[model samples]
Target chain A: MLARDDQPTPPLKRTPLHALHVARGGKMVPFAGYDMPVQFATGVLKEHLHTRAAAGLFDVSHMGQIVLRPKSGTLADAAGALERLVPQDILALAPHRQRYAQFTNDQGGILDDLMVSNFADHLFLVVNAACKAEDEAHLRAALSDTCEIEVLADRALLALQGPQAEAVLSRFCAEAASLRFMDSKPLPVMGLDCFVSRSGYTGEDGFEISVPASAAEQLATALLDQAEVLPIGLGARDSLRLEAGLCLYGHDIDTSTTPVEASLAWSIQKSRRHGGARPGGFAGAEVILDQLDHGAPRSRVGLKPEGRAPVREGAQLYAEADAADPIGQVSSGGFGPSVGGPVAMGYLPAAIAARGGVVFAEVRGQRLPMKIGSPTFVSPSYQR
Target chain B: MTTLFTPDHEWIRVEGDIATIGVTDYAQSQLGDVVFVELPKIGRQLKKAEAAAVVESVKAASDVYAPITGEVLEVNETLQTDPAQVNTDAGGAAWFFKLKIADKAELEGLMDEAAYAAHTA
Candidate 1:
């Protein structure tokens, strides 16, 4: 089998957990400018299944973590500053709570999607690794006068996700057990001060811990030492998130797509929309609110293939079996280990993107029948 | 019977006029997990180096090329249900298809086990 698209990448950067990954027989590949493991000896299928059945430890240090602190020393200052960049209710966010938000451009196009956490002193943000540099530059240029955009270059991030995650994590850090979904706190882990958040990209229940770069290996080892926790790689991470109906940075949501088109309008809280007390202060607020009221032309939807064949990314979507007209294209797709079939997500015309609708995908010159289903193929197991 | 390997990592075992073709262990390992295999139809004629089948893994899809000129005689239908068979026993039960050898002269262009091992190494 000849696999294509192995482009010559530039020199890749290694994470703090690089040595441990190599020692554990990880098959490292270049991703987001980092030398990261795509899978280990167990392979992608088993790893994806293992994460759903038990707990899986993922080294996501390649993601960008930044701390936003207002120079005035008031927490509201940082929140107010960030509110200008995203369309989320940042100022109204309760302390120690986290909310998902996206960095949108003036045209209502998504620059990047991120998680914002309200801390006791400042706002903490975690962004996609590929867009971190551009995100950093945007934050500095926009919010520099209000808050200090400090990139946590000395930090490493790890995600332990699954049903058994809480049981395995609460043993090491007592403060972690009390955290509900979207809750975060700084806890002592393996002699290091790490910020632990009860959230993850996977639809499963999990925690994302931010530890110092120097102590990342020790912390990962401690978590993996638990019987329920296994080291997962980027491959399983993608499949899991895809099955969960989560969007990847470059693939699903990008600068060309607005929040409404990407089916992320639910993320925009009612408190920030039109008719709310505080309205239209952030970038793209006007266009986004208009789309929210009028509706988007196209929307993202999940696809279940009628046959075993997977309708991969870039596959054209047709409204009918024999019609040559293309309606959409598959964005993210693969064999979902949990779904037990070929599952895919893509943007379809808003009229036909609803559940139970049929859309044919052109694969290998054949129009394969598919069913438009719920945006999420697998029910999220988040511990709310 | 004798087995030969191709630079593309396919293996074929020839016995009389029929030759069974499948991917090598190294190819399977490199491909990681096999989720779907689109086998060639029986009675289809194919030239050497032409695309014969497609293998879909969790990450991407790959094309399995024909190693020799032949007429497809049979296919491993088991792969449609259990593609993981290719990962477990690729050279044996997971053989993708059987071909009626149309040109034995093409065998001289392929590599033997030692040459394949050195080439892969």
Candidate 2:
């Protein structure tokens, strides 16, 4: 809960496309210390459905972009150094490939989830906006001797997502259609040098473009001009990712939840596990490896509310309707426009985490029924 | 018959000690899309300013308070299944409930159409 203080709050930072958002009838709100559009004139429901059927352009400039180059002049050294912090097998990451990773604390709890792309000579990373400053400091403190960290503060990130994404982006950058899922490289887009990655959070075939801040508006305007593209806001982005079963940094995975417990063990490569080439070297390896070998006490699972009422985040979960103690709590819950009903994700005791198992969520002093199911509510569409 | 509005954006149509209540068009617009609504039970007594109903949007939930003391005579059950009506026809067919006025004098505090427009402005 946020503190209700009388002190004046700091002024919110604006993205390069702030003016364009305001001009497009975006409803601005404060998010991650930035003034961002929560929804546009099209509203959340339409914007969400539009992204699934067509293409939606989003401005994600608030996220941090960093370039990590090895001081020893070898990408392998940088990858090896990074492997010490994350559980993923970064040493085997091929060129122009991107992998999802998380920064785990000493206790195995997740600090933040990020995407690491192997560029030609350096590693390009995109971290959450809320954790960027701390992530930068953590990197400098841990691997400064092995790598040179360069924070790209003058760049803007844009996501062109959905089924028609490749079609729309190909009009400007013909190379966009050729890149498969998780492929990343430097491509010339509309006369501007950009780092294009064929990956997105919407579970759709899309591309995330990292462009210069000075040319962000021009690129965004050109994309929006396409008949298949519409300007989406943070509201639809959240719903899209939620339905796609993607975890939100602070909400789904936090300082108290480990990757294994969060159902993210798939991201931890076999080489990082016990008896592999490199095993038990990363932070909290003992705890994580134990869970991998055996099982976690509790696990994250998707929830489908039996009724129309949404069981929002922080709602308690119960094993029985009249149970005095809650078995778990919802981390992220909302109306899934694509699902045509309310959907949620939360942790449940492993004993009761079976698929199709019944649980109860207390909403407004009443226990509502929910069904446990796979985390992926919507099937992902990747070029691969 | 007389129509009055509350500062909280509720509208009350009074006729012979009976009041039909719902949210204003301005309120519906501000709420964006209505996904769910919970109405009061019939025959329940409500005091002035008490929470009588709940309207939930895709993002948040809001309370619709009783404008004046009354007893719930009837509720619009259609809202339970078709909540989007609150967004499309909020001031007309989307009336939430009907009340039997307990004190006609309580209606004096509500604003007329012109006064309510100025308040919203």
lDDT of 1 by residue, A147-262 (tens): 98999999999999999998998888877778899997777876588999999988999999999999899989989899898899999999999999999989989988899899
Candidate 2 displacement at residue A378 in angstroms: 1.1
TM for candidate 1 is 0.98
Q: Could you report the DockQ of all the candidates, in the order they appear? A: 0.80, 0.42
Clashes (backbone N, CA, C under 3 Å), per candidate, total 0, 0
Per-residue lDDT value at A204 in model 1: 92
DockQ of 2: 0.42
User: Model 1 chain A, poorest ten-residue lDDT window?
Assistant: A1-10
Report how far residue A38 has shifted in candidate 2, in Å. 0.4
TM-score of 2: 0.97
User: Where is the poorest 10-residue window by lDDT in model 1 chain B?
Assistant: B55-64
